[model samples]
Target: MSAVRENNPVLTAIQAAHPVLADDLPPLQAVDVAELAAMDFKPRQPLLSPWLCSQDLAMVFAPRGVGKTHFGLAVAFAVATGGPFARWQAPAARKVLYLDGELPGAVIQQRLWMHCPDVDPAPGYLRIFTPDLVTEGRTLPDLSTYEGQAVIDAMIETDTALVVVDNLSAWARSGRENEAESWHPIADWLLSLRRRGIAVLLVHHAGKGGQQRGTSKREDLLDVVIGLSRPKDYDPQQGAVFVVEFSKARNLVGDQAESIELELVVADDRATWRCRTVEASTFERVVDLANEGLRPNDIALELDINKSSVSRHLNKARANGLIKADKAARS
Candidate 1:
């Protein structure tokens, strides 16, 4: 009946059997089957449904100049206002803290104004920390170190539910990019934040290989990992056309996992994005070989995906009537 999430079964059993030792027993430390099942812990609520949940850890990575900051700021605004951000909507407005190590104060202000020209943001609801605003020519604290974390931790108000770290390269400056061990401290810090019921969204840069830069170990503990890539037919003139794909989604399935083809149209002195669920699988590479009736193996080779994924997509395409089952069988 206690509201606390404390969960230890052996000690609980001892206290239940003998009330005399209840006061002397230490706090609960573990969860047993029955106790865990009976506990009244509530499910974590989403900041952005189907992706970011309370107490969750997530990341969005993209190549340089691919709109990582734009995406991060939009997410921050959406969470702060409880808004409809692309396909996701927050249940309610919540306090958010956004830390940016790269952009200037004027640039950020411009971006915020662009997002909401007529409406004023709720006061103190979305706190921002930019390197330009730091006092006495000091830089924003490095998130990879304890001292830096302490500084940022002090900046976070108790009511703040989400913290956005814009592009890890600038904030987490202490580590070697490719060394997995270099990211351990930052990873632990992120986990600690998650344990405290604070959700974190890390904006990141993509590597030369077109994936999240640095150690893959970072994804090992994350609840969601979004990768933004310019489409295969991407043109420099095309302002912001990127594919949003989930590389690691814990509970998402079926349509929830489909990649999004997002385009930002800037005209009439305004900027807004449009998104649609892509028809093909996330692995599709637009190969000329795929145009012909090729076997799954050949298609997989062209798509740079494994045989199993090719088979799965082929089945899904057929089931959705996007492709003919007979044609697939012939391939």
Candidate 2:
């Protein structure tokens, strides 16, 4: 009845024999390699130099209450405002879409105000969509459903350059975190975003052992993977200090791979909070000394730092798998 059916007698015969097979055949989309090679392709652009690049799918994981959301919001703000995030600089002010699945709108607003008290609100540059807004009359965006497609459509419609999913666990729907098969669909959807020149940042949780709480399959397609953890001697009143480690960064080289400490310093009036970066070598040294059979107090005296710093470093090192408890230390 159609040109394809009339021209291909064999295919017609096969379709005649099996009507269902005709419906199952996929359309062909083939490109010549030489033709593709001749076309001009844009070089990779960075959203955060040495950390996140355009078309990158990155993941940041941390244990509960370790400021994962706070840090993510800060980075999003930096990207939207075209400012420095920690030590990394955003090339220019870009539109960012933050999909919040955890915190309420009021809490998110409060945290944002504390981080940027003087910033005039720019709704066009920085947009936030909570779970209720995303799933108003539809289902959650699970990457395999129509609701997920709607989210992707919205991103494209908004011309968003960066999309931050507050957390994967809250929206992953029906997929078991530990199962590799569960991540296939999600990975494919994320890849689709990359193909459209959109960068994605996924916030995830760490397991009891401090590793990402899922199959490692998610990392296969990711360009960067970072982890966050609080110090062992974390004091609530001393401001929040946490270690940020680039466990995997496809773009970093040599010393650029080193981890850093992020501390949230409150102003004298406690009206504002600024995130600062500090060297994490003390923690590394503490791990090395502890592995070499020195006690925490001895390491503190040897490093000329305080006992609390030594303890905090040791705790972070152990959690990050840099060292294990020896028989001497276990006793």
Candidate 3:
């Protein structure tokens, strides 16, 4: 009846808009394994070398106040300019549309100014839309529904190579984060973007457990998931300092997925970025944990790493004289 149809928002929206429904869409194409292999599909080139690529769906997440926005903006600027960002290098300049949800207009403006004083984006190459840009009578569209998805889709141009959504909480307003099905509409929209050869960078929040917040379903379709963790003994005065860890990566292994420590230092009138790979063999963490009086088992638990890794790091710490024989025995 009318009441039942009204209860389904998507169906109502489609009816009102007179658009094709899901059932009306064409069937998915399929081919034999050999036909699929020999389809002559173009190789996906790196958008950011070794990790992010053309048509990639990637997510970068960090706990609140851990510089997720800073990292997101840096990547956007680099890709929009075909420049270097920390350790990642964009091979060439491409069009980008950065959609900001959380920050105030003046704040994002100042940050962009700090990062680029004179270098401007190429004409039509980089565009930005923030919540502050919406008129007083209008609100930013949510990405959790098909209607919301269509509104944002209209903003994306054909030439736009990347879309940076920073981030879920602000942009996707109605979803229940813990429910996997609640994320479906948004996930399907993101996949549709990938099918159109557009890459997406999702900046999300990390839960107290230091993992991406919400259902793991968000990561099911992602090609790379980068985690930003605040350094222990972190100094509040030192803003935007964190270690970048790639928890999930495709087509990469070993050093390609190594963690990098990055710091943003803005002294005088200029800003500078510093980055370096964390040395795995140093096992400096073992020394720190031992000095803090955490036993090997506790250390492994706290670090969320295997006990074998704890043992190996402890051995390395001992070899480096970071732990005395007696102290090492107890730790």
Candidate 4:
């Protein structure tokens, strides 16, 4: 009985600490101490560290069609399955569990397969859960219930390294994007997963105005905040591109001034993403054209910029909504 109870640490601790058990149970003994003096708890270097030395709770937000989901899927695949993400080099192989509230399983599968052609989903590795868990009535479900707890238990049981939740709005009980207080419970709940040395990334949408919905609460609790914007110069029909930027990082250097332009392409059922360089001057001009709702040619002449440059900027901006087109009826 003692051996059995010792194997289940959480329950054993609970039972041992209960007042009822205090009188009858054997007094707790301090276990032999190892070399605690050598343990290191310092904040880890972000770019070079694996496992983050601690779990990283990051909120990634972008407007709809900004490829937030696509970008998240790619990152999740890279981390869970192992690879080089935008800047972080690949770590030792680990499991990844993706929980998506908005995307269907098929769509998630498509994105994963596109980005990671070699990855597979079985009992433990690279699992995708699409709004399947019933977490209602609880701010965050206690995984104590088979469904709720099963995910975390599986994560621990399989030693999962990353868990990705796609889009914050999907599970928010309040459903009010502007209400920061309402998100506190959910954000804190997700952050708790970090205690176990697993990284948790939440996919969320920003307001049309470039601020994340529930930004105050979510941002305050997270260790990192990544924002993806559509390049003001990208075109929708040609392909999708995003301006990937880091809005916040507590444990690592925040990449406020650093930005990457990424383009997506799919062929032979595989998706490839490549990073490109953009001239700051030209990119800003494109943003100007987008904000003003100028046609490509008009923007070109207005800024005395090349038409091709205007087109590129316009496409990126439209995809990211650095500028929005007025509805035909409104126009």
Best by lDDT: 3
User: What's the residue-level lDDT of 309 in candidate 4?
Assistant: 72
Q: What TM-score does structure 2 among the candidates reach?
A: 0.73
Collision count for each candidate, in order:
0, 0, 0, 13
lDDT of 2 at 1: 60
Residue-level lDDT of model 4, residues 1-331, one tens digit each, is 8887678655554453233546777898754447555555544323214324347877788888878887777776665555665555556456777777766557766776788736543446677666544357633423223233333444344366677777666645453556765565465456556656667777888885797875476677777777887655466875677777767766555343366777778889888777655455467666765566666666676666688876676566657766655321111
Model 4 misses residue 99 by how many Å?
0.5
Model 1's TM-score against the true structure: 0.75
Please list the Cα RMSD from the true structure of every candidate, rounded to 1 decimal place.
Answer: 10.4, 10.3, 6.6, 9.3
Name model 2 segments beyond 4 Å from true: 1-34, 117-123, 132-139, 144-146, 268-297, 300-331
Give the alpha carbon lDDT tens digit for every residue of 180-241 in model 2. Answer: 99887777668767877889999999999998898988898899999998755456776567
lDDT of 1 at 274: 87
Question: Candidate 1 residues 58-113, lDDT tens each?
Answer: 99999999888888888888888888678988788888999988888899888776
Sorted on TM-score, highest at the top, how do the candidates line up? 3, 1, 2, 4
Candidate closer to the true structure by lDDT (higher is better), 1 or 4: 1
Name the candidate, 3 or 4, with the larger TM-score value: 3
RMSD of 4: 9.3
After TM-score superposition, what is the CA distance of residue 274 in candidate 3 from its true location, in Å?
0.9
Q: What value of lDDT does candidate 3 attain over all alpha carbons?
A: 0.81
Those runs of model 3 whose alpha carbons end farther than 4 Å from true positions after fitting are 1-19, 38-42, 117-119, 280-331
Deviation (Å) of 268 in candidate 2: 7.9
